[model samples]
Target: MAADTTEWKIKKLIQDLKDQYSKTVRNNPDTVAQIESAVRILSFLVAGRFENGEILSELIYSASNLLVFLNDSVFKAASKYVSKVVNVTKEKIKRWLTVLEYTEVFLEMAAKKKWGTKGAWIVITIIQIMKTALRFYVLVKLDGGIGSTPAIQPVDREILKTAEDEHDNLEDAWDEEAAYSAQEKTFTLQSSGRQIRTLQAAEPGMRTWGVPESGTQSPQNSVLNRKRKMLNQPASKLTKQRKWAEGLHIARPMAHLISMYISGLDSWKPFLLACGMDVTSMYLMGDTKDLNAKEKAELKRRNMMLLYYLMRSPFYDKYTKMRFIAIFRFIAQYVPLSGFIIRPLLEYLPTWQRMYFYVWTL
Candidate 1:
C-alpha cells in the first residue's frame, strides 16, 4: 500500500472506536438505559436558550431530539436484533418517549408566537395535557422515570476548555533546524527532508483487568436505591389529592391561555392563580423525606421559576413595565440622543412580555 494518510488513519480509528462502543452499549443493558435517560433530559433542556438567536434554538432542539430518537429507539432496536440481549419493555417505553419529543421544537416555536388569534395557545395546551398523560403511563408504569434516571454532571471541563495551553518544550517542539541538530548525528539510509519527523509509539500505561474494581458498586447502589424508592412509593404518599394538585400545577399554562381567550378573569388573576397552584402543589408534594431526590429537585426548580412570573403580564404591565418606561423617559430627558434606541425597545416590551419573554424562559 502507498503511505498511510493522517485523515484516513483518523477515520479508521474513529470507526473502530464507534464499533467497539456500540458493542459495549449493546452488551450492557444498564448503559443503554443510562444513555436513553441522558438523551431525554438533554433534549428537554436544549430549547431553554432562546435569546436573539431563535433559529439556533430550533436547530439545537431538533438535534437533541434526533439524539434522543437514536438512543431511545434506533440503537436499542439494532442491539436487540444483533445481540438478542435487550430490555424490550424499556425500549418500547423509550420509543414512545422519543415520539413525544418530536413536537419539542414545534411546541417551543408556537409558545413564542406573538399572535394570540393564530391558535398556537390552544394547540400547545392540548398537546401538553395529552403528552403528560402518556408520559405518566410510559415513564412510571413501564419504565424508571426521571427519578431512577441518572444525570451526567460536567466536572472540570469548562475550566479545562478555557485554560491556556501549558508546555515544557524540549527538542520536540523546536523549529526544524534546531530539532534536526538536537537529534542523533548517526547517518541513516532514508532520504532527508526539509522538515523533521516525529516518531509515533503506543501510549505507556498498564491497564490491569479481570480483578473487579472498587467504587464500581457504589453507582449501582444509587441506581438500586432509586428503583427501591420507586417500588416502595406508597399510594398514600402520592394520593389523589396530591395528584389533583399537581394536575392543577401542570395545567397552569392551559388555564392561563383559556382565561385570556374567554375575557373573564382579570389580567392579573391568571398569573396569580397559576402561582397559587404552583404553591399548592409544592405544599402537597411534601417534605424532603416524603419526596424522592428527583421530586425534591423538581420542587426546588418550581420554587426558582416563581421568579419568572415577575416578567409575566399584569405583573409586567402594572409593575415592571411602568418602572422600565419611567426609567427610559428619565434617561431620555438627560440624554436626548438615547430615545432613538430606547423608543423601539419600549414599544416592543409589551409584545415581548406577553409572547416571548415568559415562554422563552420556559
Candidate 2:
C-alpha cells in the first residue's frame, strides 16, 4: 500500500510538470527550450545518477536559459507573494547567473588541468545540484505546499529535511567562518598576475600608501612588504600591535600566514565580488564611499575587521540558517509578475497583510 502511494505521488508530480511545460510551450514557444531543460533537470534528480556530463551540461544550459525567462515572469509572480525574499531584487535569476559564472570558470579550470571526464562531471554535478536544489526549494515554496501538511500521503520529509539540513550547514559554515575571521582579522586583496596588492596604511596626505617602489623583489616580498612596517617594534609587542592594527590596514594582500590559516576568506571573495563590492576596500573604509579627494575615509579599522568576519559568519545554527532562507523566501513571494495584482482592487488588507499577499502571489 505504501509503495503504491509513493509511486502514485511521483507519477502525479511528473504529470503536473509535463502539463505545466506543455502550457508554457503553448503560450511562449521561445520558452519551450527552457521548459525542456527544466524537465531534464528533474529527470536527473529523479534518476540519482550524477556522472552524466551530457545531462549535467543540459541542466546548466537550461538553468542559465531559464534565468531570463524566470526572472521576467515567474520570479515576478513569486515576488507578489514574498517581497523581502532577498535584499537584491530578482535573486532567483541572480542566483542562476552566479552558478553559471562559477560553472564556466570551473569548467575552464578543469579543462586546463586536463581533468578526466569523471572529474569534470564530479565538479559540475556538485555545483549543478546545489543550484538546482535552491531553485527547486523556491519553486516548491512558490507553488505552496512543499511545507503544507500531508493530507494525501505526505511527501518525503527527507527531501525537505535535507534541504533544511543543507541550509543549516551553510549557515553554520558562515557563522564558523565569521568567528574565525573575527579573531584571525582576515582581509581580502586583489592578485595581479603573480603580484598581490592591497591598500597602503600611510595616514591621509602622507605618501607611500601601499605602492611598491622600483626595487625588484621576490613575489612573496612584493606582497609582504606592502604591509605597514613596524619600524623596530619589539617581538612581543609586534604580535599584540599587529592584531590591533589589522583592521586599519587596507588593500594589502592579506598576510600569507593569515590567509593560509583562514580558508573561509578564499571562498567569500567570490561571493563578495558577486555583490559588486571589494572585500579589502570595505574593510578599510568602514563605511565605503566614493570620495574625490580630501574626504577623510571613515576608517573604522576595528569595526571593518569585525564586519569582514560577520559577513563570512556561518548560517550553521538551525534558526540562523532559516532566517537567511526566510529572507530570500520572503522576497521570492512578493512580485507583480507571479500572482493577482489586487493592491488596487482590495485596499482593506492591513499594510503587513497586503505586503504578505503581494509577496505570496509573486
Q: lDDT: which candidate is best?
A: 1
Error of 2 at 331 (Å): 27
Name the top TM-score candidate. Answer: 1
lDDT (Cα, tens digit) per residue for candidate 1, span 241-359: 65665555545656666666666434766677767876786776665566665556656777788877777766776687678789998887789699877775676565455443134
Over 313-333, each residue of candidate 2 has an lDDT whose tens digit, in order, gives 231222244564455455546
Model 2: worst 10 consecutive residues (lDDT sum): 145-154
What lDDT does each candidate get? 0.49, 0.35
What's the TM-score of every candidate structure?
0.46, 0.21
What is candidate 1's TM-score against the reference? 0.46
Give the deviation of candidate 2 from the true structure as CA RMSD.
Answer: 27.2
